[model samples]
Target: MDEFTSEELLEQLQQLDEQPRIEAKRASEIGKSVMQTICAFANEPGLGGGYLLLGIDEPSSVHESFTVCGVTDADTLLNTLQGNCREQFESPICVKGQVELLDGKKVIRLFVPELAPSAKPCTFKGKFDSKNKRKTGIWRRGLNGDYECSQQELEPLLLAKSGTSYEQIQLADAHWDDLDLSVIALYRTLRSKVRPYAEELQASDAEMLYALNLVRKQQDEWVPNVAGLLLMGKPLALRRLLPSVRVDYVRINGTKWVEDPEHRFATTLDLREPLLRLIPKLEATITDDLPRHFRLKEGDTQRSDEPLLPHKVIREAVVNAVMHRDYQVNQPILVVRYSNRIEIRNAGYSLKPEATLGDMGSKLRNPLIASVLYDLNFAETKGSGIRTMRRLLKQSGLAAPVFVSKVIENEFVATYLLHQLLGEEQLNWLTQFSHLHLTDDEAKALLLTREIGAIDNAGLRAITGLDTLSASQVLGRLHHQYHLIEQGGASSATYYQLAPQLQNDDQLPLFSGEAEASSEPNTSDLGTDTSDLGTDTSDLGTDTSDLNPATDTDLPEKLSQKIEQLTPKARRDKLWPVIVWLCALRPYKAEELATQLSRKETHLKHSHLNVLREQEKLIDYLYPEVINHPSQAYKTTDKGTNWLKHQGIEIE
Candidate 1:
């Protein structure tokens, strides 16, 4: 179940190529042909998937040539083959290797599956050469050795994925009127751009369509491949054949999954043009004006710029989602729009087996169809789609798109953020702090503090997936970095909070403790964490207790202005005492401070009485603790007396 054995591979190679199948080659050792055969099999859809055996040969009597001729220098051969495969293949492909016995002789089997449809005409050293004109060429698994597929054959190979066989299909019953003249004209125009000799093939729109096999004869009438209908057939013709293939756009007012949606739309049309048209519309709806600082002739100038989402990012993401999505999955491609993000989740995993978005090699499951889309400018340059999207997003002041090729679900989800990336200031801090002496888990645990506001040791363990000891080490590092302050004991009961100094500071912290950790975590993770948390509003500029408007609400209009002018207290007791005396018993929402203190919500949004209590600025700790647990209470801060004097009230 895990790998093909050499003996099994030999049995496979012995079978003739009747229909699409695979060949497994096993060897204690192998040669260059092994690599060539792998590339060849990957190029041919007709071959399905192929394999290479690593060990075992037949009995000497059964076939001397195929007998167990134990390979010399096996380890060296393995390394050489591995290097060749890595350097030569356009995208890295795997060949399963396993040690086994054939006829009591040791051997190794190497299994090579044919390239997925997403990868067409398997390439060698970055070039697609099916004809074998170049010594360095790719191939289709032939009955004997690999054979080079010619350009004429290659075109059909590409087209076959479009689910058509132009060479055998012919349009008979349909007349000239049945063909969409506008579509035919557009095809002609596009064809001329790539093929200079297109004009010489003189034929009416109907004839041309038939000649190209876009419209084939079916029961004495014209028919089309799923691709042909999608690309050129009239809208009415397409609706009849490919109804389920479509795009769904869902818009939400916030980032979470359950937020209210602004609108939704589903499109079933010529995927190419309709998608291209859809980008600008989505952009117009969600795009925002961003504030930017620039150097002008007069002085440094600050102005607002257009939305952050780039045109190229939108197009590339859309194209990738459409091209690679599993048409068979029966799920419509989703374009999820949120207030600050856009996620495109298609219905299929990566065409390249076990591949991720970071991988740049080409292995398409539907190569024939993908090739056509690229030629028509509706898709990306092969192997560069994800990379291009990353570059574009970064250049436009947004974080790079996150690509997920989930194998279990067979889906590809690309998340694009319509927000600014780490600025030069943040980048400088990150770079300066890269050499900090901290473990990965510890850094993550500390970062969680900044993100979720607070985290206990147990929370750290869950977030980092570390055992108690390991989690403790991580929390200890956070404490040493001064980015976090320990709240409880050292054991599992320990809790932590953001350090007051770094709580709202722009510069990220760097640890100067003993080095005992792995390399620094990647910036991508940092970007992800920052995007999740809206902003740094962790610190309030003032104390909490004097906020009760009723007790302090009607003292005097002029006195209120005078009290506001007084210096803020360093302790919450200054005001908490009076507010508690005024209101016998009642609870308040964190956001209720604005109404309670007779101030605007915007002004008191960041201020909290609990926070003042924690800082010990309160006059008396009525609760003896101010963690703001599920229960509610209040206290007075140190500035309460000065405030009473300003308000024309004497403090007892």
Candidate 2:
């Protein structure tokens, strides 16, 4: 744990919100509860470490003020705390304690480092688990407070203790004959196609399995392993060893799960075949059921009917689910088909963070499985699968898939949107402003803003294949110049939402039909959201005619009364532009303009007839644009509609 400076420490003490990494206690003396915190800080995975403060009071609310209530006897407290850590805990925990003068009183600060993976689940001597429970000798820090680890939570730790990869672990007493020769032959055929010159294809079946580490010579016997079983085991063998291993293909009627009590799935299919055959079978079943769209490639002579999602994309998604999922969880891979979307949910979070999912190269959780798929040209171990999925979705005119990687639940979910990327309603709405000459990226950004409340750099990167720098430029251009999106946040935290006029949700079409429903929750913010691609730009249209409304204040007031007498409609005509220019320069009373033009009040109504004001535009009340105060005088709009033409700035 990094040591916190005095200022950093003081800021933490004053803050009202509780941080998972910070724990404050008024324990000036050693106590049992303090040890639990120490154990939790050390045992909890992933939050670098935690802090313990001896003399601080917890603030009740954000408005409530707090102060460091400093320890009275620092030496005695330190001695007792150190003794408790050494004697009461199952193991001697290492923590750095410092005595500081806070608010003119002594305060003890302890920084407990996260325990090494091997020595984790730090607990007190009494914290061991019962026989039926998995978590013994483990205390972990959660958001609310410290708690003991559950069985499921402790399994990952035990797997970590093996120091052997999951795929490499030998299946005890399983001999080579348990493997199917036909599966091995099929692998060789696939290897020949992808790696024509590879030497492994020529090796004997048993030798090939041994070379690939699928089968090992244990105690002079060639025994198979978990990877061997998954890739090539017969049906009966797999069922007896790993009954939970299979792909569950569930079809739902609408775009989401069948969450209602009475609602049932459209169809369900459980495939118990070996992964070698299950991969293609699952793809075929889904492709046959998905709606097809006719598309043409660039410079192509003919159009072909393609599924809303590409064939390769579905293959990659399923392959990844099988290749990267945590097989230890004893859960089947769930391939859910909704009316308009398909969701692939499997046990285990992604091998890498959500931010890096699109980047090449990933840490493989099941390299043995990955290697087989990679060798067969069925999947990639280098992380190109996500990039392919994104590109294909965009090419198909479908919204990009959303990948929600939940580390706490150890789950990875891929939501493949089946509906059009830009709905016909949304496109029709944008087509109204062809004059805006918006680029594709800008249009997509607007479309996103129209659906979701806002968009950010991360969102832009997922939708478009833009790098961080490129994404920022697109957002900045639309915000600073085009006036399409309003900017929010500061620096890296900056986000872009549609301008107020563009946020017309009541008109956009709702995303409906067989689109895959997102199994993951929509709880991410701009700072943490990853590839949501779920915004339904249902009702979006901007009144282009009303954009850039202008009311020039300083029109030429010296024009003749006849010129002033021009009707508000006639004032916008080319001939009356001189008077329009004069009125734009300065506000003039209808009577004054009538007198100047040598015309009656009735004539003045025609020439200086407050046309914009009558339309509730150029106002008769306040001169500062109608939305603000408009004066009773016949002033033109300040929003700059025809001000440019009057100044000879506009050619037409």
Provide the TM-score for each candidate, comma-separated: 0.39, 0.59
Q: Write candidate 2's Cα lDDT for 479-575 as tens digits.
A: 8777887865432234566777775435455454333322221112212221211221001111122122233222233333435465545534433
Top candidate on lDDT is: 2
- Which candidate has the top score in TM-score? 2
For model 1, what is the C-alpha lDDT against the true structure? 0.48
Which segments of candidate 1 are over 4 A away from where they belong? 1-180, 189-203, 207-213, 233-239, 260-306, 353-361, 420-652
Model 1: worst 10 consecutive residues (lDDT sum) = 532-541
The true-versus-predicted C-alpha distance at residue 2 of model 1, in Å, is 11
Give a tens-digit lDDT track for model 1, residues 179-232: 466765666676667775764247766566566545555566556554455455
After aligning candidate 2 to the native by TM-score, how far in Å is the CA of 453 from where it should be? 14
